[model samples]
Target: MARHEDRDPLNEEDLAQIADLPKVELHLHHEGAAPPAFIRGLAKEKSVNLSGVFREDGSYAYRDFVHFLSVYEAATQVLQTPRDYARLTTALLEECAANGVIYCETFLSPDFCGGGDLGAWREYLHAIREAADAAERDLGVTLRGVVTCIRHFGPEKSRPAARCAAETAGDWIVGFGMGGDENRGELNQFLYAFDMAREAGLKLTTHAGEWRGPSEVRSAVEDLRVARIGHGVRAIEDLALVDLLAETGVVLEVCPGSNVTLGVYPNLAKHPIAELRDRGVKVTVSTDDPPFFHTNMRREYFNLANAFQWDADVLRELTRNAADAAFCDDDTREKILKRLET
Candidate 1:
């Protein structure tokens, strides 16, 4: 496993110990998980150029957050068809299973899959759903989709995405969320979209307190009314906000490796995940986009253990927290928790 230079690195034996710890992942991106080699292959097939997306070592390359977003979208250019999405789904689930992620809810965008056309969205969803079903059967990794809208696309464009999400609320299409450039639009402007998803009975979450501050997270819960905050770790900056999050029981999908890799914090020791947890806030760990961040579920567990001196019990608590926060149905959640118990 690759380690960030400033942090104390884990050896092979340390990584091997956490390899089979069953986990639930709640904040992964569909397009972002595309293997670099897979994207390169698709770019070749479509005759598209992705020179800017890869590094000399054949891994993703980007200098900072804004450029990372550009590179992420650039990689998505290869995923132009429903079948393409199905292939991506299969590859992602296989990687998740290998990392001991039994249940994973990934953000899938209508804009990317079908360009906000409901009919086309259904076709793409069906392809991805079929792939997920096969993966659960063969790989033992249960998959769920959170239909997400790109926040940077603005409110007008977000409506079609919300409509698509609202129309597909079900066991497989479990939640609705917004994930993109968080700094682009005012949170209130997206309230109507969240309302649409809420009316359709979709669980809500949004990216906030990541590139921005605690006020961004505060507004997401207050105006947008999300049950979960993607990367709300920055809430640690405000003790009162931390208290409020604890009081309200809003879960934060904390992604440490992504934070440190993006320079959100200097290192895991400085990251706010442990502080947030200590403050009585509901916190669960996930690798926001594993490969892009150079992490997987096992690595996430290993790093947390090393940084916080967490034992097996602490790791299990995180798994249980994730299973509880999972967007799946009650029966599915029960089954997952039962697995964790065993």
Candidate 2:
């Protein structure tokens, strides 16, 4: 086994070299990662009530993990029109493209798209997808959508979210999952939603092993049958679970920076990514909410290189993991992997 890896916690120059490697982000949230300046501008333009969502630096300010969600939603409330989402998507893809992201799958909640309704969801999805097309033309990054239900809102609301997902399943919206306050309920509560997406030919993924425990991961695997897991860092708690993940060939969308930022682990040193990788578990790196977590793909690579001593090869392999797990059709995935070869 390759024990002496390259992405350690000090190789800034090496980190710089790998920072430009083509990347595939599998866990970013559409609403949670808006630039603070963008949100503040929208709030002011609309005369909305957003008093203290920002720092004196005009960046986002949040007290804790839960508070982070409130600030995320507060920032989202100002985006009242399809144009807002379209512009946001355009700008976000530009930033992501700058960071060498060639392929991205971001979480899009119907509640935010249309507040749990079908017609409104279609309008919002169409506008944002148009922006995706424009962004692709300009930035050379393909953006795929994942319709996820906020789990904390309970299972009933998830039904409509899944319905919207089923209605929207096509070339752009290719997957579905769940991401919300982790303590909301058991994985079984959202099984129907996942099943719905899966039956609609959508690939599946779910946020597990974050605030919850390995039991949650177990439940997610057992009940949701997800193809990939979001965060999934907490699965380290059960050694058997780790082996099971490895054997099952399930991918873990690991976001080290997000975990540290949310206080899931004290720092990257304590992160379970290296261990999971060494154990043959396929773990890919991503920035779950880049700006909100004060990170980007470039910074995430730098941090991982510093923490895990990852070299360009390792970063390349991580990109492969993401590409392999991506919901893009096989032809697109092949194209992405070919581009990453450079």
Candidate 3:
């Protein structure tokens, strides 16, 4: 029998081959997706002090997950209007297209975009949707929105975010979820907001089991009743909980590179994505925040292949899984799946 290996080194050609594969991403953040240079230019235009957000080498600088969240929000300070978000959406989707990503669902926060006002949120949504339409027409990459609540901001504040999301639930904004410090607020606290979005005909997902424990995953499922989970890799700690995830067919939008960068795991080999997949969990790969983690869709695929010896067939299976679990409508999903098939 062949001895199991944690990783297999790949040359540039191998990485290039992986880079050409069609991809789908189900976990990404709108503000967090901003390119470093883009944010820097905005900061320069506004004369904001973003010196703390970057390293000496001109990359995002943060000490840990909490600090990363701080930097992520800090970068949003420059993005203060509908036009700013429009530019951001266009640039982000174009980047995704360049990386061979055919479909991507990103988390957008009303807290940053509109300060939780429904009217203002509508304006921001209009700008974002216009950019998405342009990107789809020109770049052949479909972009969808998942309106996200900031968990650290508490449940009372999540109310307006949910209201904003509920008002705009449609073809572009197809789902609702939460991101931020997952350790804050009890799951039941956000139940009303989740229910509101769900009643408004939006699919549900939430960040869990990344910065917290398996119990958080249970709460996200039992209380919020999310159909998908963002970074539920920590569920592996609880065998029964892992079994529950498998039994329920709840998709995990696993961002292995982000997990390692955030110290959720020491490194790629220590990440539980492959193990969770082997246990029947529907796991899909994404770059939660590409620039912040210094990763892209191509890097994600290449690293996963290197770490797990996953061949083209395995990578395609993961892409198909993302398409199956995407928040888009059936027509969009079918289109993306057809691209993956070819």
Q: Which candidate should be chosen as best, given lDDT against the real structure?
A: 3
Give me the displacement of residue 54 in model 1, in angstroms: 0.4
Ranking by lDDT: 3, 1, 2
lDDT, residue 6, candidate 2? 35
Please report the TM-score between candidate 2 and the true structure. 0.97
Q: Write the per-residue lDDT of candidate 1 for residues 102-159, one digit (tens) a residue.
A: 9999999999998999999999999999999999999999999999999888998889
- For candidate 3, list the clashing residue pairs, or say none: none
Question: What is candidate 3's lDDT per residue for 233-262, written digit by digit as tens?
Answer: 899999899999999999999999999988
RMSD for each of the candidates: 3.8, 1.6, 2.1
Off by over 4 Å in 3: 1-17
lDDT of each: 0.90, 0.88, 0.90
> Which sections of candidate 1 miss by over 4 Å?
1-17
Worst 10 residues of 1 by lDDT: 1-10
Q: How do the residues 66-131 of candidate 2 rate in per-residue lDDT, one tens digit apiece?
A: 898888888898999889999899878988998889999989999998897899999999999999
Best by TM-score: 2
